[model samples]
Target: MSSFQNLKKSRDARRGKPRPNTSSTSGTSGPGVTNAGDGTYGMDDELASKAREVLSTALGIPLGQDEPGLEFLDDPEVEITNVSSYDSHGRKQNVSPGIDNLRSKDQVTGKGKGKVKQPQVSNEHVRKRGKDEVSHELYKSELEGSGIEVHTLPGKGRGLITKRLIKAGTIILKTPPSISALQNQHFQRVCHGCYLTMKERNIASCKNEKERYEKKMRGELKIKLNRCSGCKVLHYCSRECQLSDWPTHKHECIALQRFRKMYYKTYPTKKQDDDDLSWTQASPEPVRALARIIWKRRVEREKNGGKDGIWWKQIASLESHVSKSTQQEVMRLAQQAQHLQHYLSASIPLKGSDVDVGEDQLLPVNMEDFGFEDVQEVMNFCSSFHVNSFTLSSPSLTPIGVSNSPLMALSNHSCDPNAIVVFPNGAKYMELIAIKDIQSDEEILTSYIDLSCPYDIRQRDLKERYRFQCDCKLCEKSKNQGVDWVDPRWCVRHEGCKGGDGKGKMPVKGSKGVVSVKCDKCQEDFKVNAEEVLSVVQKGVDVLDSDEHRQLDYKTAQKALSTLIPNLQKHLPNHSYPLLSLLRLSSVSHTPPQSPKDLQIASKHIKQAYEACYEVYHQNHATPTLILCEYAKLLSLQDSEQTKMVDLSRNIAMKNTIIRNLLEAIEMLTKAVKQSEITFGKGFVVGKELEGILEGCKEEMERLKRS
Candidate 1:
C-alpha cells in the first residue's frame, strides 16, 4: 500500500474502526455495522461473548469488568532480607582504611549530647533481640557492590562509597517509605493507601458527580474510592488498600473522632467546617508522622518489655542535628510541641460521663504516659524530618507528598550529582538509581534541588537548609571562573554574533539588577536590563503555571506559544521553556496538527528542546526521554509521499530527507525506550508505554523499507 494509505489504515486500526470497502458499502448500513445477516449483524451476542471470553483469558481481566486500577505493591525485583539475618551473618560494613568503622567507639561516646533523649535500648541491644520477637524484615539493596562501604568523613559525618566500579543508571537502593504523609493540599484529593489522585485520571475537574459516574460507567475512569466506614474521613481506591492501611489509621481515626467532639464543644453551635479546621489538618503532617513514630516505639516497648525494635533503633539513630539547631529553632519547635500537645490533650473525654466505647473501638493514649513531655525530643524528630524528608513526587518530580526513607536518606548530596532518585511504583516507594558512572571508592550523590539553578542560589540553599558548603566539581569550576558564582539571567547576545560589530569581544554574563553590558569579546553593546528580561520570562512562566493552559485549544495554545517564545528568547536564549512549549503544542496526539507544516515546525522544536533539556538535565532523566519520543512521533507523521511529490529533483531530495528522518526517528525511539526503562523500572507505566511506541517505530521502519 502507498504511504498515505498505510497511515490511514494504521489510524483506522488504532481507533478500532475498519476501512470502508467501497464495494461492500454501496449503501448506508450504519456506522461500522455491515448488514451481513440478520438485523443484529453488529450485535452478534454469541460472537461478542466469545471475543470477550478470549480477551478475559488473555488479559486476565474479568469478562464484564474495566481495567484494573493502580496498585502499590512490593517491587518483585528487590530481594527482601531479614535485618536480623543480615547482621548475624557478620556481613556488615567492609571497613577500609579511609572508611569509618561501623562500630566506631566515637559513635557511643557522641550519643550523650543530643536534645532528643537517646533510646534506653541502644542499636546493639535491639540487634540482640531474640529472633522470635522479630518479624520478617526487608533491607534496601545498597549493598550490591561488595566494595560498597559506609564511612564517616573526618569532618562531614557519614557518606557512602562503592569499593568497586559502578556505572550510571545502576540501582543503589529500592526501598519503601519509613513514614509517609500527603502534603496538606493533596490530603483530600489523594488516597492514603495507594496515593492515587483524581488528577492522574484527569477527573479532578469533573463538572459534577454525574459526569464522574458517566465516565466511570463508560470504562474511562476507575478511581472509585471506598470511604473508611469507621472514621468516615479517609478514602481508599479499593477494599484491599483500606485493609492494608487499617493498622496505622485505626489509631489516627480514633484520635480524629475525639478531636472532632472537642472541636464542636469549643465552637459550641458556631458554624464551623473544614475551612475552620484547615489549620488542624495542615499542621499535622509532621505531627501525624511523629504520632506514628511514638506509636511504633510504644508498641515495640510493650512487645519487648520496654525495649525498642530494630526499625525504631534505625529512626532514633538517624542524625537529629539537635546540636546544630539554633535557640530560635528550638523555641519554635517547643511552641509546635505545645500546639500538638494541646490538640492531643483535647482528645480525652471530659470528666464524668458513661462514654462506653467497647473493645472494637480504637482509643487515644495520654501523651504524658508515652513520655511526650520531653518536648526537646519532639523538636529533634522535627529537625530530622526537616533535614531528611524526601518529597514524594510524580515521575516528572512535581512534589505531591513528603516521605522519609531510611536507606534512601543515607545517600548524600552533590551539586553535580551522579545519581537520580525516582518513585517508580508509586509515591510510597523510592528508587535511587545512578545517572552517571563512578569508579570504585567514589561517593554516590543526588541533587536536593534543581541543579540547573545558578551556583550562588544553590550554595545559599544548601547552606541555609543542609548547613554545608558544597565543593562539588561544578561549584569549584564556577568559583574559579569568577567571584559572582553565576549570573541568574540568560545572556542577551545573539548565538552567531562574533562580538563587537565585527570586533572580537563577546558578552560575558548578565546579572540581575544590571541594566546593560558591552561584549567582552566583540565590544558590541546591548540595551537590555536583566530585571526586564526576567520579568518577560516570568510572565510566560505564569501562563504555563496557570490552570487554563491545560485546557487551551491547540490553535490558541500555538498562538500563545508564538507570543511566549520571543519574550523567552529575549532572556533565556537556550531556555528549555520555549522549546518545551512548542513541543507540547505540536505533539499532542489527541489534537492533530493543523497541517504537515505544523508537524515540521514541531520536529524542529523537538530537536531544539531535546538539545536544551540535555544540556540542563541528566541524559536518563524523564524530560529528555519525553522530548525524544515526541520528536520520533512528529517524524512518523511525515511518512507520506505527498511531501515528495512537490517537483522531480526536489521530490528526490525530500525522499532522501524523509528516509533520514525515519532512520533518526528509529535511533531516538530506541535510545528513549532504553533510558525510560532505566529511569523508570521496565514494568512502570511510562516504561511500558515507551516500549509500545518503540515497537510502533520499528514497524514503521519496516513499512518504509517496503515502500
Candidate 2:
C-alpha cells in the first residue's frame, strides 16, 4: 500500500471503522460495502443514498448522483473547519461548520420552490487588478526615465542597455523585489521589514538618559524589535513595518507554527535551543523564499482568477538550467523539493477541521491546489533561485539577506563591469548605479562575484556556481596577452634580472614538478621547485579562506607573518596578491594594537597592502578604496601621550616624521573619499563615513602642526 493508503487506514481504525480487505471478493464488507472481482467496490443502494445526504449537508452543496463506493473517503484526513469569509465592511470573517452560513436560506433547506439567490462574487479581483496595473506602470515609468531599457543580446539572452550617456554615480534603476527573505543567521539580528541591523535600529526608545546619550553619540537609537507573537521568528522595527509585511508574513507565521508543533510531536524529548530552532534547521532561507512564492501565487490565483501578473510571469520565465544540471545537482534539487512538499503538506491546515477562528483559517478555495503541480515543478523553482537570486547587501556592502528581482537579473555579468547594484539606505528596493561612464547603446554589465581574486579562481567560481564561462574584455585580454599582461595578482619578480622597470615581474607558470618565470623585458629565465613556491601560496590561500583566521591575536598574527613574508619575498613580488592578503590579515589580526611598536608595525603592513591593492585593483574600484581607508585610519592612531613626549624631548626628527605621516594620512584619506564617491556613490553611507574620517584626519593634522 502507498503512504496515503496507510494513513487513511490508521485514521479509519481510530474512528472505530472496520478496515476493508482488498482480497476478499465474495464477502460483504464494513459499512454496507462489498468488493467484487472487478477493481471497483460496491455499496448498498440505501447506504449510498444516506451517505450522499450527509455529504451534501456537510458540504453545503446538493448532490446529483450517488457514488458507487467509499473512494471519496480514501484520504480520511479532516481539514480545518474554519473558513475565511468577508464581511460587508471588507474585513475577514472566519465562519465555522464548513461555509454552510454562506448559503441562502431556501438553498439550505433543499427547497427549489423560492427563487434561489446566487452567491455574491467578491470585487477583490477588480481591486487586485488595478493595484497590479498601477505597479506595472510605476515600474515602466521608472525604467523609461532611468536611461536604460531591456534589449536582446547575441548570446546572453535578455540584457539591460543604456539608452543615453550615463555618468558615474548616476542611479540607473531602482526596483522593488519580487520576493526576498533574510538568511537564517540574520533572523534575529536584522529586521524583517526594513532589513536594518541591531546596531542601526533608528527608532529611539531608550528608557534611561545614559542609554539615550550613548545611542546619540553613536548616531543610533535603542529600539526594541516587535516580534511576531505567533511564530516568534520574525522581528520588525515597528508596528508599521509589521503591518506592511503582514501579507507575506501571515502565511509564514502559520506554516512555521504548524511545522514546530509537528516537529515536537515527532521528537517529543528534543530540547529547543533557540526560538527559531525548529524551522531554522528544517526550512532555511531558500526554502522559506520558495514557500512565500507558493503562498503568493495561491493568493493571486484566488483573488485574480489566476491572472499572470508581472511578478509571476517574470519569476516563471527565469532560467532553471534543469537540462544542464549535473546528476548530483539534480538529486539535491529533488531532495529539496521533497522537503518542501513535506513541509507544506504537514503545515497547511485542511478545509474543515474545528480549529480556532483566527487569521490561520484556510480559505474556502481547494486545499489540494498548493500552487505547484508536482515535485518537478518545485525542483524547477529551487534551481531557478541558484541563478536568479541576488545577495542583498546593506549600503556598506555587508550581506544581510537574499532577494530576487527579475528586472535586476536581466543585467549580464562582466569582471570589469561599468554598473553595480546596491540597496541604498538599507531599504528593500535595489538601485543600479553606474560605476563608469557609458555611451549610448552600451550594454550594462555588473559583476556577479567578487572581482578581487585572480583569473583562475574567478573562472572556476563562475563555472561552478553560475554554470558559464566568462568572456568579458578582461577575460579576453588575459587569455590573449597572457595573465601577467592583464593581472598583477599572480606575478613573481626575479632576483638577479635587471631589465625593464626595477619592479618588473612575470606570471608564475608551470606544472607541479617545476615552476619557471621569464622576465618580460630581458627574457631572463629562472626555474625553481614548484613545490616550494606553490605550496607556500596554497597555505596562504587556505589561511585567508579559513573562518578561524577571520580574527587572530597579536602573537598568532606575528608568527604567521614571520613565516610567510620571508618565504614569499624570496619567490614572489611584494605586490603579489597572496603576499598582500597575508599582510592585510596580519595588520587586522592585531585588533586595536597592543603597544605603540605594535601599532607602527600594523600601520606599515597596511601601507604595504594598500600599495599592492592600488596596483592590482582599478583606481576607482571599491577594494582599493576600502584598503586606502584602512591605511589612513591606521596611520592616524598616534596617541596624545606620544605627541606630549615628542614635545617634552624637543625631538626635531621625531616631530618631523609625525608631521609627514599626518600629511600623508590626510592625502590618502582625500584620495579614498574621491574613489569612494565613484565606487560606492556620493550619497552612500560608505562615502559619507569616509568623508567623516577625512575631516578627523585634517583636524589631527592641524593639532600636530600646532604642537
Best by lDDT: 2
**TM-score, cand. 2:** 0.68
Estimate the lDDT of model 2.
0.51
Question: What are the per-residue Cα lDDT tens digits for candidate 1 across 365-451?
Answer: 346565445657766765665455554444433334445655555555554566655555455566766667766666656555334
Per-candidate Cα lDDT values, in order, are 0.44, 0.51
Candidate 2: residue 298 lDDT (0-100): 74
Q: What range of 10 consecutive residues in model 2 has the weakest lDDT sum?
A: 23-32
The lowest-lDDT stretch of 10 consecutive residues in candidate 1 is: 23-32
lDDT of 2 by residue, 1-707 (tens): 22222222322332242211110100000000111111011122232223211100011111221111111111121211100111111011101001111110000000000111111112342222222233234347457667666554444555566768988877778777667777565666566877765434432134333454567799665355556666667877666667767677676775665655545544457776435453354455655766677777777877877664556767776666566778855765665554455444433543444343322222222324856666576667766654566544444333444566666666666667677665545556766777678777676666554454566765554454445666676766665665235256666666776774323333344446765666665666776667677777877765543312113344655777778877887777666756765676566555357778777877787787777766655565444555676676666665535665556237868777777777877787787778767755665544454455566767767776776
TM-score, cand. 1:
0.60
Query: TM-scores of all models?
Result: 0.60, 0.68
